[model samples]
Target: MTDVLRASKFSEWKEDFNWDTCLTGREKYGNFLVSILTSETNGHVINLNGAWGTGKTELLKRLYVSIAKKQHPVIYINAWESDFINDPLSVICAEFLNQLGYLLANSRPKKELVDINEALNKLMGSISKVAYIFKLSSLGYKAVTGDATLNEEFDFSQTLLDLTTQQNSSSMSLENYNKSIISSMLGNQIDLVEGMKEIRIQITSISHILCDIYGCNSPIIILVDELDRCRPDYAIKTLEVIKHFFDVDGCNFLIASDTESLQESIKCIYGQGFDSERYLRRFFNQKIALKKPSLYNYLLKKGIDFDGMCPNMTLTPYSNDNERKIKLLSEMLNNDKFELRDIERFIQKLTACIGYISKFNVKNAKFINFCVLAYGIYEHEKNVNIFKERTNKMSSHGIHCNGYISNGMSVSNFITIHFKMVTLANSSKRYNLDGGWGSCSYQTEMLTVESQDLQTRDWRREDLIECERLIQNYRNAPNSFLLWEDYQKLIGLTDAIE
Candidate 1:
């Protein structure tokens, strides 16, 4: 492999999404979503549902770019990235104003732009007050304002004396003094409902301005990604902010997340019996589930060269047919329910094992299969005892067992039996040969085996006989046998590479 390909193989894969680079054929779905979002005049909330690592972020990015190409105003917010902030409304409002400024950068008539800016300022002010109210309710008045007096127990005589002192100095009335105290604690004197009403009017004006700048059919599309990865409070609050505040005409929302995970988040906030599904149903107009890409297509896009990983392996199961290797690997991944992120890690570790094998110039078919099986088991179980237990099953049952029967007996079963036989033989020495003749003494050196409790079942007579036969067959060709120590070394080598 070239240096570029080697670096690309182990590095994190970031999709640079465009219509031409959409390998999973999801651009068609993107176009369909665009049609739905643009066809409506009123606001619509779309829940784009997909499990983690199913490419939700890429789909949302593609949709954002596609909508932008049609001269529509769009904003993409990563909710996971912004969940550190206490208020999701603040994050959304900041992004909205930034994107809106960009959209109105070169618009005609400076007076209309000024009017839009004024309306946006009012809108932000209204949102700030609402967010402040939420903070006061959750964090307490003293925590928000840092005013110790607000938290102190009220004293009627002391309070009256303080008010009288202020009244004497500034000629302030008792009513005004009470209003000042309320304003100081609340951060604003406006009623929350009145403030919300003002926000709605300002949003209406801004939405009208956006329609005038673009077209009557154009609406501000806000795409929120990774909502499921956020904290439960942050995730639920984001949904509430979008539904209650931004549910105006000419404003649409496309939130991409695992709806099931988000539902669990809702349950976390409202308790187990809250009917989270019904709550989500009230926010979204439609829920569209994204289909996961096929394993073949995903690997092709990833550009994995299995042939290059182990070249010149005439004796291997997949030497002549790389497609068969891919098929078997795909079956293993699907059986384990490997997500895209898990698949990437598996490939990285497998490549590291192959790299270690290449140092010894041992790229045969059996060794290649051993590397694949070893890493697959490692990725799935991450326990040596589990690996030995599975291998032991292959020894006693001849690979025809329930879990070992997949991908046919030739490829899967043969590899398991081969792995077990080699490791068992190499695990310990058969004898300590020593002889004495007259005054001279002779001692044969024995290989020192590392103590490992592999948790294998008791060996049967047939298993020992097979182990002895295989050990003697490969006595002169030790390189053909991969020991348990060698497997451990291979796994250790992968840690550094990863």
Candidate 2:
């Protein structure tokens, strides 16, 4: 099998259709993100909510590139990544400095910014040592800032005051800074609280300094992605970091995650009896959800690159038959409520399992797509017997189960499963004889007396037993992820049996 070559999508923005197509119903959603990120507002939290695998990260990536084109300072944190850190404050301070470091370098701010960088390095090291800079790193900071053995060894109250006093030619500014810095520190006798307060102030001061350096007109846009995937403790800590530390003048936070996932995480942290949604609402100023794209538009957007295909390409241009297959796939997606990632995953797995399938023969591709997705949704992928049996019932009952309530609501015994067929021989009354039978809507079907012939077909007990044959055959394949017997059977029970 030959592999299909793919192109780099980094420059895909150059193709105006990506944003203009409205295929995903996100044209305005993307536009709104760009507006908020580039807007003059400061200290605002804007949310982009979408289900897992529904393109939240994709949307943010596009927005990051677009807004940064205007020289806006933006910080992107994959919260899922930093969740491993023991200290939430440490993660917050680290990301803030990491991204700001790039902005400072990229903006080429005046020479005074040099002093700020030095101050920040010292401030960051101190915050890490005080909070959770792992054991080994903590030892280094303990030596640099103060001894690890004593309380008075590290004067948390004097960190900023001493740093500011060094620039005493500007004595008035130093006095005001010292008062604000030490007053809060001395008032809070708790050592941890004092360290946290200092960290928050340091972030705010840097934000203000950046705004001044970048001409004070640009609001820094911080994109926090994948918070929904973090552990509840990690996720909540991330939110607190944003609320307390990044909430300052000249800062706008655009966080991309689903409200439901975050709510669940909150519930996990607090008791199940807690009102998680209400608690989560305190963090964001506005939330915008990306609506699920319609079947036609969704398929259209996913299939656009298939126009010019090669053996080594990830996509294949549809022929008359492939287009028909796509229509059926689209209906399956609609019926099953498959999110963007699910659909893409189904395709990727389908391609790898059965490489280089012609547009004329996607029957097996469509068949495996549904089965694999069904097993995935149900978390039954590890059990082939259960998966196969469940697939049969799923197709027979005109039902679609996504395994869990949060992923999607399962559709059971529909009036008409639009993408499915109605079989004549058995209980699969809502099934068709051909896998591609349901895709044609704009055309007319020929009425014939030959339908009476299907009524007389013979029944066999072996037909049911052959299901075992299928299970074993799939297991024998070099790549078991894609089952290639094809969806010829997907037409319905009798279709496969006959």
- TM-score attained by model 2: 0.57
Model 1: colliding residue pairs:
316-365
> For residues 44-146, could you state the per-residue lDDT of candidate 2 as single tens digits?
8877888877888767766665565555666667888767775555555455444444343333344464556555444544333323322233344345435
lDDT of 2 at 66: 57
The candidate maximizing lDDT is 1
Backbone clashes in candidate 1 total 1
lDDT of 1 by residue, 1-498 (tens): 111121111112223656777767777788999998877658899999988778888787777667766656677888998788787766676556544534443233324443444443434433343333333333343353353432233221222133224224332233454444335544554554455454455455556655653342367788999999999999988998888778777788899998998899889878999899998899899999887666656666666666576564322334545555555555545532456666767777776666557655652323444433444444434444544443312234232222222333434443454455444433232341111112213332222111122222433334334444444544655566555455555565565543
TM-score of each: 0.65, 0.57
